[model samples]
Target: MSIINQMLKDIDKRDKPQFGANRPKSVYLGRPLRTRRLRLILWGGVFALLAFLALSWLHERLSAPASDARPSAEQLQIQRVPVLISEPTQDAASQRADAETADASTRAEGEPEETRPRTTRGEQATVVVTDLEPTQTRAEQPVEPVEVAVSEQVQVPAQTSMPVVTPADTTVTASDDPGEMSIQRSGNGVGSADRLFQRGMDALSAGHNRNAVQRFREALLVNPDHIGSIEQLAAIQFSRGFAGEALQLLRDALERNPGASDLLLLKARIYERIDEPRAALDLLRGRQFRLPQDADLLILQGAAATELEEYTLAIASYRQLVSWRSDQGNWWLALGFSLERSGDPLNMQEAAEAYRRALQDRSLSESARNFALDRREALGY
Candidate 1:
């Protein structure tokens, strides 16, 4: 029995169980139909869901109004508004054309009608009656007949009264004689000398200086020793920058007419222009002494002193000028400039004070005030 069991066990082991080894066999079966069916169903479900979403979107788009689909309220409102159609009016164009025609007619009346604008159609313009008024024929107005009245002739007595008349003296001189000298002068009936002088003045006014000089010389020849001509010639010479010639001429004239303040002042001006401030100062000082109340001479003297860098003397002269004409702002300005240049602190302060005084004067020009202010700023005051 043990032997039989061992053989059976060997057979069972061979047929049923191997400890660690097995024979090769097919592991796979054919694909299941239900798996394919499940795959097809899943794919169909995905496609159906996609088709359903697309159809839903199409239905939403088609079902909504076009205006509601837009996001903008203004665009929706614009779409909702109705458009208006306008018809053109011919009356406006006709009125414009009529106004243009009337304006052209007025302009044509202003100019010659032959020179007026022509129509391209080559049609002659006809006069159109704009107003209807009553017209009367000349024969329709009746002519009135004239009437005459005759009266009986009557004679009246005439009386003659004898006039008291003075007897005509044969020796009496006739006052209405044409040869009688009439000493009466009329308006501006200039003599030959005055006319020549006026012509020279006109030439001077017309800027013909050389012609003016010639005319003035002729006037002097007509009336030699004419002071006006001499003085004017000297002035013109000085204005032309011939100071030496002017000085000599004026000096000669001054010899004839001494104590002429105007000539003295003119000489002083020429001297100042020539850079001879000392001489100018001397002349102005002399004039000031002669005429103590001459503010012009005092101002001139101050200017000369200022030109010479004699600030103290300038201040003194300007002070005198200010005393003479207290109302003159230019004098105060001159005094300020002089004092400012003096280099003395006290005088500089005095100059600033003088400028302030000048600013208070109503006659001071804006340029003058600005200049004074500029000077004050420059002095660091």
Candidate 2:
């Protein structure tokens, strides 16, 4: 009991209400200050964590380059990289080199490389081509150059050769070649008669009537009965307007040879030349009796009739001549002209037929055929 009493007494003293309330208030104030300090420490630790995370993000963004950070599709493409290894054996390398050289030589042979002018950034490359051969340049290039010759050609005079004449062996005296008879004999043997006749004929041909007549007379004196000389002389006299003299000589000649158609033609020519066409016609008609089928004589008669303006009779004569010598275009032309002048349609038809025949003749000249054709057209045949 005593121990219990003592403990109670101690407890009662310690367990007082006011003492208890005071002790609790002091403890609360001290605990409140410590609690606030702990809260501030916790908040500071959270802010430090957030600041460290932000600084780490800023460092990561500033450290990376823009191009390395974002790669494009082209940059993403994978490339095959070659790794250099050891070279091949010597024999294999030599064979490969030979094949490459052969290929290069073959390409060079097929298509030769052409040289072209090259230019750099600021300068141009100059190229010059020179011909290999001198003669080749002459053949390939088109250039005209003045030519110089080492020597010039010189002309020499030609040498001429002439014939040499010698003196004749024969010498004749005047008595040896005598008068007209001797002159005629000598002229005949040496063609002197032919030469004299040719001179006279030439004078007549040149229309020198007086000279022709004189030459013919001289020839006749050398030989009195020279027929050609006499006829020529008569023709010259007739041409000189001496028809009477021509007729006298022609008549005398005709008496010697009545059948001479040439003398008759000559006499008719003389008669016509004197404007006596009727007498010429009579003479031509008388000769026709002697020479019936003479085409030339008939042509002469046609010409004489034409001169007399007897166109019908002239056409008849020309027709007769054409019938005898069908190849003669002049006869046809004459007949056509005369018939056209006659104004007889029947005669005109006959004349056209004659010209047609002449045109068909191959032996006629082109001019003659054309003339006959022109006459036929003029006659309206």
Candidate 1, 165: how far from true, in Å? 44
lDDT of 2 by residue, 130-198 (tens): 332343234444322111111112222223242333222212223311210111124332244445677
Give the whole-model CA lDDT for all candidates, comma-separated: 0.64, 0.62
- Give the number of the best model, judged by lDDT: 1
Provide TM-scores for the models: 0.42, 0.37
Off by over 4 Å in 1: 1-178, 182-196, 207-211, 218-225, 239-241, 289-293, 343-349, 362-381
Candidate 1 yields a Cα-based lDDT of: 0.64
| Candidate number of the best TM-score | 1
Off by over 4 Å in 2: 1-225, 239-241, 289-294, 309-312, 337-349, 358-381
